[model samples]
Target chain A: MQSQSDNEYGIQVYNASINPAPRCPCVLLLDTSHSMSGEPIAELNEGVKTYFEEIRQDDFSRFSVETAVIAFGASDQGVSLVMPFTSCARVEEVQPPRFKAGGLTPMGQALERGLDLLKKRKREYRAKGIAYYQPWMVLMTDGAPTDQWREAAQNVQNEARNRKLVFLGVGVGPYVDMPTLTEICPDNRPPKRLQGLRFCQFFEWLSQSMAAVSRSSVGEQSVRLPNIDGWACVEA
Target chain B: MGKVIYSFGRFFGQAIGHVKAHCPAPGKDRPWCDQATADQMRGARSKTRSEPQLVFDRNGIERRLGPLMAKGGEGKVYPLADHQDVLVKIYHVRARNGDRLQTKLEAMRQMRPMLNSPLFGWPRLLVFDEAGTWRGYAMRRLAGVQMQTLCQPQLIAERLPHWSRREILKCARSFVSLVGKAHRNQVIIGDINPGNLLVDPQTCEVRGIDCDSYQIAGTTGLHTCPVGVPMLMAPELLGRDYSRVRRTFEQELFSVAIMLFRMFMLGLHPYSRTYGEDPVANLKSGHCAFGLGAGCRLPRGPWYKIWSHLPFRLKDLFIRTFRDGHGDPAARTLLEEWNDALDEYLERLNKGWFDPHLVPSAPKSSHYRGSDSGRRKGTASQGSRLFRKNA
Candidate 1:
C-alpha cells in the first residue's frame, strides 16, 4: 500500500487533477452481445487499443480527455463498467479482461449505465468547480437491444439534441438495428455504418475528432473534424 | 530509454545538452529533441519506410529529410539528411493559419543572427519545395524533453529521475532568463506554455521551441502570435482574436507568473479547484486558486506546503499577481522583479535555509523569518503512500 503522502490525491486522482486544463469526458458504450462473438469482438478490442493510442498522440487530447468503457452483454445485470473514467495522460491496463463476448444484448440498460455515469461525472465536475467541454458518448453496436430501452433511448436523444452531449452511434455489422441506434442519436449527427470490420479506422477517426474538439479555444464554435471518408459510411 | 547518448548543441558560447530520441524505428507514440545517434540509424530506417521525403532549402536547393524526429497536430519535425546539426519543422497542410505562418516566419527570419542562441531554436534558414513554394525552416535541433513532461510526477519520475525542487527552481529561472532575453530583443513569446519550452534534465538548461508563434515587432508590421494555449493566456487575451489584439510585455509577465506557479505547485493551474473549474473560465471570472479572498481552496496535492515554503517576497508577488493583477496587466510583477526574487530564493536554498523538499512537509505552525529560517529537514518519508516514486 503506497502512502498518500507523496501525492495526496493518489495516483489516479492526481493524474486527473494535476492538469487543470478543462476536462473532456468520453464514454464508450459497447455492444458485447453473443452476435458479436467471433471476428467482430476481436476487431472491437483492437479498435479500442487503437483509439487509446490515437488519443494519447495528441497533446491537448491527452491532457483533457477522460474516458470510460461500459459494455452490455455478459454481466447478469446486463451492464459492466469494464474501465472506470481515467485521464488519458496516465491510461494503463492496455489489455486484460480480454472482452469475452457472451449473453444477450441489453443495449438499453447499458445506455442507462453510460448516461448515469456521465451525469454523475459532470455533477462531480460542477461541484468541484472543474470546467468541462460538452461530454461525448459513443455507442457501437451489432445487434438489437433485448431489454426495455425506450426511456433510456429517449434520454440519449434529448441530451444529444440539446447539445449537452456529442453522441456518435455506429453500427458494427449488418445485423445492427440502425433505425434503433439512429433513434437514440440526434438527426444532425446520425448513425454511421462501419465499413466492413474496419474498427481500427473508425477508432482513428473518433480519436481525431476528439482531439479536434479538445484543441478548440474558449468561445470558439464547434470544431469541424477531419473527414470520415476513411472508415465511416454515413447514410444519406 | 536505454544506452543513452548525450549530444551537445552549441548555444551562443555555452553547451546545451540533449538526449538522443532513442527511435530504434520511428513508431507512433514517441519522437523528439535529438536524433537516434546519427546517419547510421537513417540508412537502416529509410529502406523500411516509404519513399525518401524531400524539401527545398532557402537557396532552392532540394534535400531529402531523414527519419522523423517528432510529429504534432500542427506539423512534423524531421532531421535533414545533409545537415547533421539541423532539423526542419514542416507545418501541417491543414494549419488553417498557413498564410499567417509564412508571413510570421519570414518576418522572424530577419532576426536569425541576433536570436542565434540554440536556446530559442530560432529559425536558421527558410526551406521550400522544388516548386519554390515555402515548406518550413531549418533550425538547430534542441536537446531535452518538454518542460511540461516535468510538471507531472509520473512523467518526471520517468524522464528526470533524480530531480528535486531545486532543479524545478533552476529550470524556472533559466526559463525566465530566456524570456527576459527575448523581451530585450523586442520578441514576445506570446504562447507561453510548458509544451513550448524544452528542458535538458542533465544541465537543467531550457530551450524555447515553436519560434513561429512568437509575436515579433518586425520592421514591416507587428507580426502577431495567433496561436495560444487558453489556460496559459493572461486574462486580457482570453477569448480575443490573438491576431488582432497586441500582446504587451505586461501580458507576457502574467503568463510568466502562471508558468512559475505551475512549476512550483506540481502543475496545478492557479485558477484550478481541487476538482476544479477549468483555468480558462476561472481566469475569466478573476477566481485564482491562490491569493487571499480568491475563495479558492489549495489543491489536495503538495500545493499548500509548497506555497507556504516559497519565500514571502515571491509569495507576495504571486498573491498580488493572481488577485489584483488579473485585470490590470501593468499591475503584474516585472520580469526583473522575478529574477531578483529567484536569486534570493536560490541563494537562501544554497545556504541551507528553509525546507527544500520536493514534497516538503508542513510543520505545526510558527513565525516565518524568510529564507534565513534554514528549516530544511533532510528528505524524509512524509507522504509517500500510493505515489511510490520508483527511485
Candidate 2:
C-alpha cells in the first residue's frame, strides 16, 4: 500500500479535507505554438489567472472546482501537465507556468494526455466514492493540428456522446481549423470562435458555467449554461 | 496597499495618533463621533485622492458618496458619506443605457407601502451623477450573513456546526414567510437565488436583498426582470429566450419551492440526481428523483438518512411542488402552504411530539447500491408508494 503522504497529480492523497465537497474537474488544453507568441500568449496567461481569481471568490466553486492545465508545442514534452488538478483555493498558492510559445501544435498528443488525466481523476473519485459532476474539457487553439488527430477526435466524440464529459472547443483566431473542432466536439454543440482577444470574457463565462455546475447536485440534471454571446460567435 | 498607506498617514501625521481635540462646536459634544472618528479621518484624507466621488440627489438633498463597498454584475455599491445606514448602487457604464432601467427604478421608488417591512432592503431614493447622468439608486444596507453561507450545506456544516434540523426548519419557515409577505405586496422576486437573500443565524431572521430586481405588478413602464439564475428558474423558463418572457408570481413560487427544498434537504436540489449529467435536461424532462414517479427514488447519503425525520405534510408538499407541479405552474405549492407546513412541523418538534434522537442512521448497505431491503419501513415507504400510485 502507498504511504499516507503519497500524492496523486500533485495533490496530497491523505488530505481528505482538501476536497471534501463534491468535485468538478476541468482540464484546459491550450495551444502555445509559435503562432501564439506575443499578445495572444500574454492574454491567455492573464485570462487563466483571472479565471482562477474568479473561481476562488466563489465559496462553493473554490472547494469544488479542480483545474489542471495542459499545454502543447512549448517544448519536447509535447503535452505537458504544467499544473495538476488542484482546488481553486490552493491554485493561488502555486505560481502558474509562464509559456514562451514555440514549435508546432501537437493537438492530438495533448487531447490524448488530457483524456488520460481525466480518466485517472475519475477513478480516484470513485475509489473514494466522492460524487462529482461530469468533467469539462476545454480546447483552445489558434492553428490546425500538425499531427495525427483523428483518434483523439473520435475519443472526444465518444465521451461527449456518452454524457461522460462536456467538451467545449474554442477557435481562438482565424487560423484554427473549424471543421476539426466541429469533429472533436460533436455533441450537437458546435465549436465557437472567440471574438477578438476576449480571453477574459471567455474565462469569465467558463468560471460562471463551472460555478453553476458546482452548485447543483452532481449527476442529476443538466446545468443550463449562460448565454455565450459575450465572448463567442458562430463561425462564418 | 491603499489601506496600508492610509493607516501610516493616520498614525504618523496626527502626532503618534494621540491627538485629541475638543468638539468643533463648544458644549455640544457629538455622541456618534466616537464611533465615526476613523471614518472622519478617512474622509479628511480622501479629499486629496483622485477616486471619483459619486453625487446623489435624494429628494433635492444632495449626498456625496465614499469609496465602493462592493460591486456586482449590474452596479457598484458605495457608502453614502453622510448617511451611515445607506449605500448607493451606481450602475456601471454598460448598464447605464439598459432598456427601461430608469422606469424600473422609478417604479421601485413609488413602492413606499412595501418598504415598511424590515425583511426587504427596498430602494429608498433615486440617484444620479453630477452631470445628471442616470446612475442607480440608494438602499438600506443589510447587516447579516449571506444566505449563500446558510443555504450551502458544507458552509452550514463548517461555520454553523451547532445548527440542527430544527434550526434548518426555522430558517425555511422564515424564508417562506418572507416570500409570502413579498407576494402580498404584489412584488415577484424574479431572481430568487441564494445570493439575493441574507440570514442572521443567531436570530433566524431572513432578509431579502437585491429588492430592486423584483418584478413589481401593475407598475406602468417598468421593465420586467429579463434574466434569471438557471438553477433557480422554473422548469418552463428553462431553454427559453429569457428576454421574450416576463416573470410571473407562479415562477416566483417555483423558485421558493426550490429554495425550501435546498434548505430542508441539506442543499440537495429538487431536480438533481446521480444518473443525469445535466440539471436543465432533468428539469425540462421533469425527472426529479425525489418526486412521485417510476424510478423516482431519493439519492442515498445524508439526504436519505435524515429524510424520514421530515414531517409527512412537508414531504407531501415537496412531492406536490416538485412532481405534480414539475411542468404545470398551477400545481405548485403556495408560499402560504409552505409557511404553514414548516411552522407546524417546528411546533410539533417544540411540543415534544417528535423525538429528534430517533432519527435513523444510514443502513449498513448504502442506498446507492440499490438495496431495496435497506429502505426505511414507515412513512418513507408509504410516501413512495403513494407517489407511484399518483403517478
Return the number of clashes found in candidate 1. Answer: 16
Give lDDT tens digits, candidate 2, residues B19-104: 22311221134322332222223212211224448664633345678666655556667766755446678777787666477777
TM-score of chain B of 1: 0.80
Minimum summed lDDT over a 10-residue window in model 2 chain A is located at: A7-16
Count of clashes in candidate 2: 8
Worst 10 residues of 1 chain B by lDDT: B378-387
In angstroms, give how far residue B180 of model 1 lies from its true place.
Answer: 1.0
CAPRI grade, predicted model 2:
incorrect
lDDT per residue (tens digit) for residues A59-83 in model 1: 5677778889998896575789998
lDDT of 2 by residue, A92-140 (tens): 3746556778889999999999999999998776544345788999999
Q: What class would a CAPRI assessor give candidate 1's docking?
A: acceptable
Report fnat, model 1. Answer: 0.22
Alpha-carbon deviation at B225 in model 2, angstroms: 2.8
